[model samples]
Target: MTSVKEQEATRRLMVFLQEWDSAHKVARSHILDNFIKSNDSKTEPELELEFSQGASLFLARLAAWLRMTYTYSTCLRKLLRSIGIFLSAASGHRYLIEFLEIGDVLILLEILGLNYHKEEDKRESVKLLQLIADAGRKYKELICESYGVQSLAKFLATSNSAEAQEDTQILLDSLGHSNPKYQNQVYKGLIAVLPCASPRAQQLALQTLRVMQDVVGEAPTAVVEPVLGVLRSTHLQVQHEAIQLLKVLMAHQVRPALLEGLVAFLTPSCRKELTFCSETAADTATLGLKEPKLVYTQQAAAAKIVGVLAKESAEVAEELIQMKVVHGLMVAVGNLDHVASQRYASISLEYFVHMFPFLEECVKNALGDTLFQHFMDSPETWYTKMDPLQAEELASIVIDIP
Candidate 1:
């Protein structure tokens, strides 16, 4: 049996939805005023009741307007936009959140991602996302895991409109900044769309990956291969974004298998040529080339793998060195020609410095003279307040000739 209050609320929502053209303006103002009053009220139940009534009415109006090929009126559209902002502002209001069903949240998100046709409407969508983003961890997983992220990523990947793409990325990135569970799920969806994704989609994916590092801390080794695949993309911008993502991953450590992959791709021989392949076609008045295919070198692919390994503890580092990465970075750095060839050469050296006291002999043979000084000079920056002399001395001992 439906509660009396729910039945009454439903009636009010229907009235608002039906008389939107005439009553929406008055209804919108009444809802806004009620929201303000409720927020300031001492009674929690009153606040909840007030917010639920206003939100339901606003949602009804939006749903009715969206059902038609054209909006009912400009006032209705503006009211819809205002409601989105109100929800965003009321994000932290416990009452407002409780009043929001999953269906209510989805309605707002759909407006942001799909329903809005005009640029102004799209901007309203961004405002809605911004509101949810502002809600932080509170409603993050609620909005994200419920297929909201997948829909947003799909829109971002397929939509050619620049404003829509930008809004989608902003929305996705904001959500990605939330809880780790949501970030991981959203990232998986983003990556799943990679094959047919446009340059914009790929760029957004990379951006999302960087932000996700905050949520997930260091990215796991599992992300290495897919991230490397991005690095090998034919689009220059995609490559640029991939490298940016790689830099963030490198801040952590790397795993052995991942390190091997980085070492292989960053080798000198792999830099011989650009690896993308493009085929051109001639139209009546123009010639165009489709986006080229990615060609992975054992080297570019290794960068992400190396980064994953670099985030591990000393024991893991020692184990990986035992597997030959210590020699690989040394070889890459020693050969000036190969220094630039390795995408993460400097980063590898930084990771190597941590292993100095434990693996003095291995470092001595690998790091060499000039590289040793650079390490000594830059030692303090990476390790915080450790004594400069200690750092330099360690560098000297480790990078000394075998």
Candidate 2:
């Protein structure tokens, strides 16, 4: 059923496919021309079935060229752009499988790191890689084997494009899940993004890091500093994401850094006494927090993090006690005007009271005898006092109520 004109086009495609190693750019471009559009008079299935040995030869040839070329060019970009088009058709699933075999996954990842390409070009590469990554874990591990994780982190940290950064974040999230072989590398790569210049990257990194916690085996000692460094971020979401990551990544070495970071958020006097590894982080902690209530909000969040950590591990509870995390919790409970700070701090203190029993007095001291009595009788009431904003901001651990 191949039409005369269609057969001629297919002949040219077969010739181009045969001369792939030496085919001129114009011939390559023309073959890819109308084929890129799925709505062409000749559909992918038709071209694929009729183009002699199948249309995937086009993909194989393209991948071979991408692997061999070290330089970026208009032709390369067009080829890269055409990849997604071909790889998306209904018949494209097999091509996705074939792409990994051709080493295009590695080549696409390398494009993310190369300097000559525009961020858009890099994103196209990311999109293609993301398709392979999205296929499932086997494909994801192939990307990891190709050093996909390191290249992904570098892109997230360096790209000025938010869309590109966010797209890479999704790729990383997929890569990190259940792929234990590469998770630690993925973890390190994301942690490196924590201190990068872009808050967008930092936020994206933290978001992905939160997903990685249950899978990543041991929290590396070097991770503690960069993880703590994010606490000083002006973006509350970034700070909150860091706190979420700490809940699972809390190693013995992490104990003191977390305590110090939490204490720094409590009071101006306390903040001045503490210093993070970065001068900018220290400065952001010291000078960035001017609003009094915002400081109270920070206290509430810290109290919540401490509460969760203490509830989970006896070792963590012991560390918090040694660091006088009780005093910080007490400070939060004393901020009565902010219902969130008082309730979260008091709830946090209950973890210590129940676990260590010695910190009951700290709760009584901060909440007074009457409130402390009610707090012990029914802790759920403290959760109720949280208005919608308070609950949304500070209640990641608390149950959602209508």
Q: What would the TM-scores of all predictions be?
A: 0.50, 0.65
Tens digits of per-residue lDDT for model 1, 273-345? 4222222211111123222212222243343345455565456566556555554544343333222323354
For candidate 2, lDDT tens digit of each residue in 169-282? 998888888677887888889988887767789889988877776677556677766776665555777767877778767754566766667756544334744334354433
Each model's lDDT comes to 0.53, 0.69
Segments of candidate 2 deviating more than 4 angstroms: 1-33, 39-47, 50-53, 64-70, 75-77, 88-102, 135-138, 249-257, 264-274, 280-322, 326-402
Candidate 1 residue runs with Cα over 4 Å from true position: 1-60, 67-82, 88-102, 110-123, 178-181, 193-196, 251-254, 263-293, 296-402
RMSD of 1: 11.1
Backbone clash pairs for candidate 2 read none
The model with the greatest TM-score is: 2
Count of steric clashes across candidates, in order: 22, 0
